[model samples]
Target: MKITLFEQAAYRYLPPDFAEHHDSVCDTPYSLVTHDGMYSSMRNFLDELMFGARSGFDGIAVTEHAQSSYDLMPNPNVVAGILAYQTEQEELDVAIFPMGRSLGKTREPVRVAEEYSMLDVISGGRLVAGFPVGLSYDASLNNGIPPIDVRGRFNENLDLVLRSWQDPKPFAFNGRYSQYPQVNIWPRPLQQPPPVWLTGVGNPATMQLILKRGFGFTFFGFAGSKLTAQRIFPRFWELADEAGLEHNPYQVGFLQHIAVAETDERAEREYAEHVEYAFHTGLGAIPPQMLALPGGIDIRGVQALLRDPSDFGIYWQMRQASLRDLIDSGTVIIGSPETVADQLTDLCRQHRIGNLHALLGFGSMPRELAMRNIKLFADEVAPRLRNLWQGSGFEHHWWPERLGGTLRRNLGEKVSA
Candidate 1:
C-alpha cells in the first residue's frame, strides 16, 4: 500500500467557542484572525509537509479551498511549486501531490495544464496530478459560477486540460465553454501526463468516468469511513467488474484522519479535544446549504440521498459530537500504533485500497502535537501497512513513475468527450 501524509492548512487558533458564533466557510469573519496565528497556521503546514517528506512518507498531499478558515489554500499549485523545488534540492524522492486545482471553479483551463507541467519538470517528473470538480460553495458562492453550470464547466475544462497536455502540436480548438485560435502548452508533463486522479463522493457517474477513462479515483472519509465505505467502494468495484476490468486495488485511494500515540489511552487523552475541534469547528460548522447548493447534485442523487441518507453518515450530527462519537462513527481514527495500524489495515484490505492518504494534522491541533502525530505514524503505523498488497500481481498505475509506479496506458474504454 502507498501511504501518504495529508493535511488541510486549518487556522488552528480559532477560539474554543467558535462554532457557536461562526461558520467555517464563506462569510467567516477575517477579524477573528491574528497575523501571528495566520502565519503560524500556514508556516506550520508547510513545515509539517516537509517533515513528512523527510520522515519517509511515500508522498505528501495538500488540497485547495477558498474563503474558508478550515483550509487556507485557495491555490495548492503555489505550495506544490515550493515543495517540488525544495524536495528536489533535498533529494527527497516523494511525490508532490496538490490534490489539487478544482476545475469547476477556474476559468483558465490551459493555465492549469501549464502549471502542472511546470511542476512535473521542476520535480523531475514526480507529480501526481489531481482534479476535483469544484465544491458547490467554492465554485458558486466563492467564485461566482452558476451552480447549475458547474458540472458542465468541469467536463469542458477537464477535456481542454487533458488535450493541452497530450496534444503534440499547436492545434485549433473550439469548446462549448472556451475556445482558442491555437492550443499549445510548453513543458508537457515529464510522464506523458502525470497520473490523473479525481475525487468523488459516491457518484456513480463519476465512478464510471474514472473507470472508463483510466483515471485514479479518490474518496474522502470526512463523512466517516466505516459508515460509507461498504456502500461506496463495493459499488465502484462492481462497476469495474461490469466493465470487465480487474479490480486493481491501486486504482483506488482513500483519505482518512488518523492520530497515533504510544498507547490508546494516551492517544485519547492527548488528541480527543483537538479531534473535536477539527470536526465541530471545521467540517461540521460549514452550513449544509453551502455543501448542497441548488443544482449541485443531480436530481437522482438528491432523491437517492433523500430516500436512504446513509451516504452522508454522521455528518448531520457532527457539530455537537463528542470524541467518542467521532471515533464510534469512524470520522477519525485515534489510538496506539498497533490499534491504528490494525484498523487501517483491515479497512484497506476489506475495501481493496492500495493508496492511503493519512490526514494527520487537523482541527486546532498544536504544531508540536501535529508533528508528533506525523512522526509516530511514519515510524510505526505506516511500516505495518505498507506490505498489504506487495504480491497482488498488480502494478500501481495511479502513481508517478519515478516513485516505482508502473504505467498502464490502457485501463478500459475511454469516456466520450
Candidate 2:
C-alpha cells in the first residue's frame, strides 16, 4: 500500500481580457483562468513531488497527453528525465515518472527504453515503465500512424523493446512496424527486464496479455467504481491463472484523482472549480460526433453523467465531488486528510488492490492546492496504509535512482544528463 503522487500536468489558462473576447473561440469545455504560469505550474508540481518523496510517498508518477486542456505534459519523458536528474542530486529514493505513452516511428521504443534504462541505472534500480496503447487520435496524429493500427503497433513495439532488453546477444525482429537484423540494444535496464505497468480503461485482451507476460495492470479509475475494478481485476487474475501464471496480487494497480484539505468543507469548495473544468472543458475537447457512434458515449453523455451523476460514477467526477450529487459514492475521493485516507484505505481493502496511483494534479487544479493535497497525503494517509501490507515487499522505484551510480558513471554523465 505505498502512496504515490500522479500528475497529468493539465494546461489551465487564464487572462482577464481573453476570457471575455475569446469565449466563443474557446469552445472546449476544460479551460479555465489560473494565475500560475507554465514554469511556475511545473515548479509547483515538482515541489509537491519533492514534498511527497520527503514526507514518505514511495514514488511520484507523471503521464503524457496532447492537444487538449485535460493535460499539458505532452512529452512526459522530458519531465521524467528532469526528475531523474534532480532525484540524483538530492539522493532521494523517490521514483518519478513511472508511465508514458508508447513509442512511434520517429520515436523508437528501444531508444525510450534505453533512456529509461539509463535512468534506472543512474537512479539505483528505481524505474517503472508504464506502457499504454494510446488513444486513437493522439497516437495517430502525433506518430503519423493510423488509429486502427495503433494497438497492434503498440503490442509489437513493446515485444521488440522487451526482446531487445532481455536478449544478451544481437537479435533480429521482423515486427509489423519494426524490423532489425542482429543489433543489440545498449545500456540494459537495471531491474532485469525492468518493471512494466500497462494503463488503460479496460481492454480484456490487453489485460490478458499483461497477466500472461507477468506485467503489472493499471486501470484508470475514472469511468467506473471500486466494485468495477474488483470485478475486472479478478478476471485478469483468472485469465492469468488459466494461462498458468503463479497468481501474484502485486501485479494490479488503480488510478484515481484525489484532493485532501485541512477540512472537508474547504476541500469541497476548492475542488469544485476543478470538477467543473474536468467535465465542461476536459470532455468538451472530443467532438460530440465522435462519441455518438456505436459503443461511444458522446459529449452529451458526459453532460448527462455530470447532470445525473453516479456513485462510483464516470471518470470526469473522479476527483471533485462538490459539483455533483453523488460525492462519497463514486471513484472521486475528496475530503480532509482523515476522511480521504479512510476512503482510500477502505477502497484498497475492499478491492484487494495492491498499488494505488493517487492522481493529485489533474482537471485544471491549481498548483498550490494540488501541492497541499500531496503533502497531506504523504504525511497522513501513507503511514496508515503501509500497515496493511507489512511483509509484502512491494517497493516503488524511479528510473535514474534505480540504476546504480557506477553504471550511470560508466554510461557517462551525458547518458542521463
Candidate 3:
C-alpha cells in the first residue's frame, strides 16, 4: 500500500473554550490570534511534514482551507511547492501531494494548471494532484460562487485543466464557465500528465465521475470511518462492477486521523485532550447549514440526506464530543502501534484501499508529540501494512512513475486483476 502522512496547519493556541465563543470558519475573529502564535503554528506544521518525509513516510500531503482556524492554508500548492523543492534537495523520493486547489472556488483554472505543472517539474515527476469540488462554505461564502453551480463549475474547470496538461498543441478553448483565447502551459507535467485524484464524501454522482473518468478517489474519514465505510465503499465497487471496470484497490484512497503510542492506555491518556480539541473546536464548531446550503446539494441528494443522515455520523455531536465519542464512532483512531495497525489493516483490506493518508498532526498537539506520532507510525505501523496488497497482482497506476507505479494513460487501458 502507498502510505502518506497528511498534516493540516491548525492554529495550536486556541483558548480552551474557543468553540463555545466562536465558529471556526468564515466569521471567526482574527483578534484571537497573536502574531508569534500564528507563525509558530504554521512553521511547526511545515517542520512536521519534513519530519515525516525524513522519518520514512512514502509521501506527505496537505489540504486547502480558507478563512478557517482548523486549517489555515488558503492554498495548499504553496506548501506543495516548498515541499517539492525541499524533498528534491534532500533526495527524498517521496511524493509531493496537495489535496489541493479547489476547482469550483477558483476563477483561474490556468493558474491551477501552471502550479501543478511547476510542482511536478520541481519535484522531478513526483506530484500526485488532488482536485476537490470544494466545500460549500469555502466556495459559496468565502469565494462567492453560487452554491448550485459549484459542481458545474468544477466539471468545466477539471476538463480545462486536464486538457491544459495533456494537449500537445496550443488550442483555443471555449466553455460555459470559462473561455481562453489560446490554451497552452509551459513545463507541462513531467509524467505526461501527473496522476489525477478527486475527493468525495459519499456522493454517488461524485463516485460515478471518478470511476467514469478513470481518476483516483479519496475519502476523508473525518465524519466517521466505520459508518461511512459501510455505506460508501460497497456502493463504489458496485458501480465499478456495473461499469465493467476492474476493482483495483489503488484507485481508492482514504485519509484518516490517527494517533499511536507504546500502548493503548498511554495513547488515550496523552492524546485524549488534543483529540477532543480537534473535533470540538475544529470540524465540530462549523454549523451544518454552513456545510450544506439549501441550493448546494441536489434535490435527490437532499431528499436522501433527509431520510438517512447516518452518513454524517458523529458530526452532529462533534462540537462537544469526548474522546470516547471520537474513538467509538471511528472518527479518530487512537491506540498502540499494534492496535492501530490491526484496525487500519482490516479497514483497508476489507474496503480495498491501496493508498492510506495518515493524519498524524491535529488540534492543539505540540510539535514534539506530533513528531513522535509520525516517527512511531513510520517505524512500527507503516511496515506492517505496506505489503497488504503485495501479491494481489494489482498495479498502482494512481501513483507517480518515479515511485514503483506503472502509469495508466487512459481509462480504457487494462488494469491487472
Candidate 4:
C-alpha cells in the first residue's frame, strides 16, 4: 500500500457554538473568522504538508472546496504550486497529488490543464492529478453550475484536459460547454502525462467511465470506511469484472480520517472533540439538500441510494453526532498506534486497497496534535501498512512515474480532440 498524507486547510478557530448558529460551508459568516486566524490556518496547513513530505510520506494530497468555512481551499493548485517547487528544491521525491480543480465547476478548462502540467514540470514529473466531478454545493451553489449539467460537464472537461496534456499538435475543439481554437499549451508536463485520478462516491456510471478511460478511481471514506467499503468496493469490482478487466488494486484509492496518540484513552481525550467539530461543524453542517440537488443524481441512482443508504454511513447523524458516535461509526478512528494500525490494515486488506490517503490533519486540530499524529503514524503505523500490497503481485499503474509507477498511456487509446 502507498501511504500518503491527506489534509484540509480548515479554519482553526470557530466560536464554540458556531455549529448551532451556522452551517460550515457556502454561507458561513466571514465575521466568525478572525484575520490572524485565517492567516495562521492557511500558513500552518502549508507548513504541515511540507512536514509530512520531510517526515517520509510517499505523497501529499488535498482537495478543492470553495467558499467553505471548514476547508478554505478554493483552489488546491495554489498550494500545490508551492509544494511542487519546495519539495523539488529539497529533493524530496514525494508526489504532488492535488485533487485538482473541479472540472464540472470550472469555467476555464484549459487553465486547469495548464496548472497541472506546470505543477508536474516544476515537481520534476511527480504529479498525480485528481479530477473530481465536484461537490454539489460547490458546483451549484457557489459556481452557479446547474446540478443536471455537472456530470455532463465533467465528461467533456476531463476529455479536454487529457487531450491537452498528451496531444503533440495544437488542435481545435468544439463542444457543448467549451470551445477552443488552436489548443496549444507551453511546458507540457514532464511526465508525457502525469498520472490521472478520478474520485467518486457510489456512482456506477462514474466508476464505469473511470474504468473505461483507464484512470485511477478514488473513494473518499469521510462517511466511515466500515459503513461504506462493503457497499462501494464490491460494486466497483463487479463493474470491473463485467467489463473483463483485471482487479488491479492500484486502480483504487481510499481516504479516511485518522488520529493517534500514546494510548487509546489519550487519543480520544486529545482528538475526540476535534473530530466531532469536524463532523458537526464541517461535513455535518452541509445540508443534505446541498449535496444532492434535484437533478444532481440520476433517477436510478436516487432509487439505488434510497434502497441502500448504508453507503452514506454516519452522515445522516453527523450534525449532532458525538465523538463516541464518530468513533463507533468508523467515521473517525481514534486510538493508539497499534489500534489505528490494525484498523487501517484490516480496512486495506478487506477492500484490496492499494492507495491509502491518511487524512491526519482535520478540523480544528491544533498544529501540535496534528504534528504528533503525523509523526507517530509515520513512525509506527505507516510502515506496517505500506508493505501490505507490495508482495501481492499487482502493479501500481496509477502512481506517478517518478514515484515508480510503470504508467501506460491511456490503455492505448488515442488522444483526440
Cα lDDT tens digits for candidate 2, 1-417 = 555678766555533232223321124333453445666656766676666666666677877666545556566777777777777688877765557755532247667667777766776667777887665445655456654466566767776666667778887766667676765767887766567777755445667666655567877776545435665666677777788875444566777767788898998898877755554444433443232232233345446545654322343343233365335444467888888888878877766576788877665677677777777777777777766655655433212333321111211111001
Assess every candidate by TM-score: 0.98, 0.79, 0.98, 0.98
Cα shift from native, residue 102, model 2 (Å): 1.9
| C-alpha RMSD (angstroms) for model 3 | 2.7
Look at candidate 1 and give me any clashing residue pairs: none
Q: Is candidate 2 or candidate 4 better by TM-score?
A: 4
lDDT of 4 by residue, 1-417 (tens): 788899989998988888889988888988887889999999889888999999999999999999998888899999999999999999999999998689989988899999999999999999999999999999889999999988888888888888888899999989789899878988788887788899989898889878887889999999988788888999999999999999888999999999999999999999987898888888888888889887888889889878988888999999899888888878987799999999989988888899999999998888988999999999989998988887778888888877989887754452222
Instruction: Tell me the tens digit of each residue's lDDT in model 3 across 1-417.
Output: 999999889999999989999999999999999999999999999999999999888898998899999999999999999999999999999999998899988888899999999999999999999999888999889999999988888888888888888889999978777899999899899987799999988898889888988899999989889878878889899999988999999999999999999999999999999999999889999999988987888899899999999888889988998899889989999999999999999999999999999999999999999999999999999999999999999989989999878888764321111
For residues 1-417, what per-residue lDDT tens digits would candidate 1 score against the true structure?
A: 998989999999999999999999999999999999999999999999999999999998988899999999999999999999999999999998888999988888889999999999999999999999978899889998888888888888888888888878898878776788988888888987789999988999999899889899999999899899999999999999998999999999999999999999999999999999999988999888998898988899889988988888889999889999889989999999999999999999999999999999998889999999999999999999999999999999989889999876543432336
For candidate 2, the 10 contiguous residues with the lowest summed lDDT are 408-417
Taken over the whole model, the C-alpha lDDT of each candidate is 0.91, 0.61, 0.91, 0.89
Better of 2 and 3 by TM-score: 3
Output the lDDT of residue 365, model 4. 89
